[model samples]
Target: MTPAARLSAAIDLIDIIDAQRIPAAKALKEWGTAHRYAGSGDRAAISGLIWDVLRRQSSAAWLMEDDSARARLLGMLRLERDMDVATIAALCDGGRFAPDTLTDGERAALTSRTLDAAPAHVAGDYPEWLDPYLAKAFGDDRAAEATAMASRAPLDLRVNTLKGKREKILPRLSHLGAVETPWSPLGLRIALGADARNPGVHSEEDFIKGAIEVQDEGSQLAALFSAAKPGEQVIDLCAGAGGKTLALAAMMGGKGRLIATDHDKRQLAPIHERLSRAGVHNCEVRTPRGEADALSDIKASADLVLIDAPCTGTGTWRRNPDAKWRMRPGALEVRLKDQAEVLDRAAPLVKPGGRIAYITCSVLPDENGDQVRAFVARHPEFSVQPPEQTASVLWDKAEDFAKAALQSDEGWLMTPRRTGTDGFFVSVLRKL
Candidate 1:
């Protein structure tokens, strides 16, 4: 497909997304089905355009003085991708399946003046409602932090020790130019290529045979925070499909009791299949009979209880850019309430002197550092565990262990900007 046709497809998908309030992935899938003539490359290019536009939508809108899909794409081309105005104009000219010619105002906005200064709100790519929260979380570097999140992320995978070590899988993935992540011994960072979603290495026999799992380096780091030992009982509360559960299983050498439970049965249903695929035994899946009845017998029984709680997913905007735009201020309140409830319910499952790890893939303080602080305050028996001690138990890499141990008044915040991984916040707490 011509560049022009790709632009047209992006416009169509964006329009559908705006009108139907559907996810960008759903909109793109529907658009692709309707345009079956487009090949794989065409779909990839169009999807890239849509995602890039969404990631920098605030800045793109500010640059173009319009928020239309075409305007956003044009702005992204000129500013983000560094496409010259002449090139964009040439593409917009009456070409086959191109977007309609650029409007007079859009052309003027593109060429007339320098967009040297964007307001903090636009540059941050965050909604106005989130400014206070972001400021509190990031302090002085909020813009830089948010800009980093707005940028594209690398493909990271964790080696499944249950099947093989990183050394074993590295040779198999060499064709894709996989490199060991500098900080994470268990992580491999793949060089970005044209096919971002292909999961090329994951489709290989090694991956299918439980040699590796597609997990973000940051998420792998969070799973390591648990430090589950062999023959110890652990509970992955709110374990959605058990990504961390698999990591924990490998950590435990597939021994001991590892119960993966979630309130939603539909989400837990796939864990059985994944467990089979990964050759994971000694893991059990539990669906809540009712919130009250589920795990009633297990209170204060677990050596480790990990609450991978649900949040706004603000930290993962690099991978799922559309979620930021879909998130509303009102919805965040609902999420905070749910998180508190989950924390309250899961806290009792940890044995005295055992640790409970509170985790979220959110950058917002309300869901992360602040949440941990509130939990400690409400439950006097629990106190924040020293991250250094937790890190020592979790990581083999000396540098990662040192970095992860930094003390915070409440807990640690791992930003993509600082950690070169997805944004995550983990707080380890112990019952006195």
Candidate 2:
């Protein structure tokens, strides 16, 4: 596709996203289906451009002094893509399937003004409502963190211990030019290249046979906090597709039962197939017949209960930039309330001496550290476990940031900017 055509596609996708209130990915997929003439490369390029624009849409619009999708697309080209005014105008000049010709003002803004003077919110491309939260999360480094998150993220994979060890799989994956993730022993971070479009790694014999699973390094670290032991019963209270449940099962050496449950049947339903594909046998799926059936017979029965609670997903803005645009303060409040309810309901499932690992892929303190603090206050019987003790129990497998952050009684906050992985917060509390 021509550069102009790609810009046109991005404008169309963004409009659909803004007008229909649909997700960017879904909108892109639907657009692709309707435009079957677009080849694989065309789809990839268009998707990349769309995501890039979304990541910095607020700032891009501010620079262009227009908020429409086309304006944003042109702004992205001017600011991010670094295209000159003459080049953009030439591309749009009477070309078939090209974007409509730019107005004089639009062309002038693209060629003349400096964007360095824009406000922090516009330059950072984050919502104004999130300023306080981002400040709290990053302290003095919020701008740097936000900038890092605006860039594309690398692909990460976790070596599944159930089928093979990292040592054995490392040799096989060497052909893919994967490097050991600096912080995660079980994670392999692959370098982006021209052939990055190939999904061969996930479909390879090793992945198909459960030697590895595509998971973020931060997620792998969060799963490690479970500290599953042989013959110990574990419950993934909010297991969505059993990513960490399978990790816990591997930690248990497949010796104990791992029951994975979730309120969303559609999400949990795929776990059975994934578990089979990963060669995970000890894990079982349970769908609550109703609200009453969820807590019955399981109160204080699990040696370990993992609450990978739902949240605003502020930490994953890099990968899902559209989420930042769609999120509202009201919706975030509702999610926080839902998270608290889930924590309260799942707390009782941990045995008296057992531990509960509360986790969320959120950067906000209210959804992470603050939530755990509140949970601890409500349940006097539960005490925050020291990071050293938890680390020792989990085979001493912790990154430097994990050791430092988890050293506190509250737990650890893993950020993508700091840790080069997804943002995750994990707190382990033991019942007295």
Best by TM-score: 1
- Please, what is the TM-score per model? 0.93, 0.89
RMSD of each: 2.4, 3.0
Prediction 1 global C-alpha lDDT: 0.81
Which pairs clash in the backbone of model 1?
none
By TM-score, how accurate is candidate 2? 0.89
Evaluated at residue 379, the lDDT of candidate 2 is 88
Question: Tens digits of per-residue lDDT for model 2 on 1-432?
Answer: 887787777788888888898888898899889999999888888888888898878777887899999888888777666789988887776578888888899887887776577766677788888988888877667766776677667788988888888887888888888889877778888766321354578667898898888888888888887688889989898898888887888888889888998888777877887889888888878887755565477868889989999888877888888888788999789988988898888778888899899888887888987888898899888888876665554354454565444234677777766778777888888999
Candidate 1 TM-score versus the reference: 0.93
**Which stretches of candidate 1 lie above 4 Å from their native place?**
100-108, 111-116, 193-197, 393-407
The whole-model lDDT of each prediction reads 0.81, 0.80
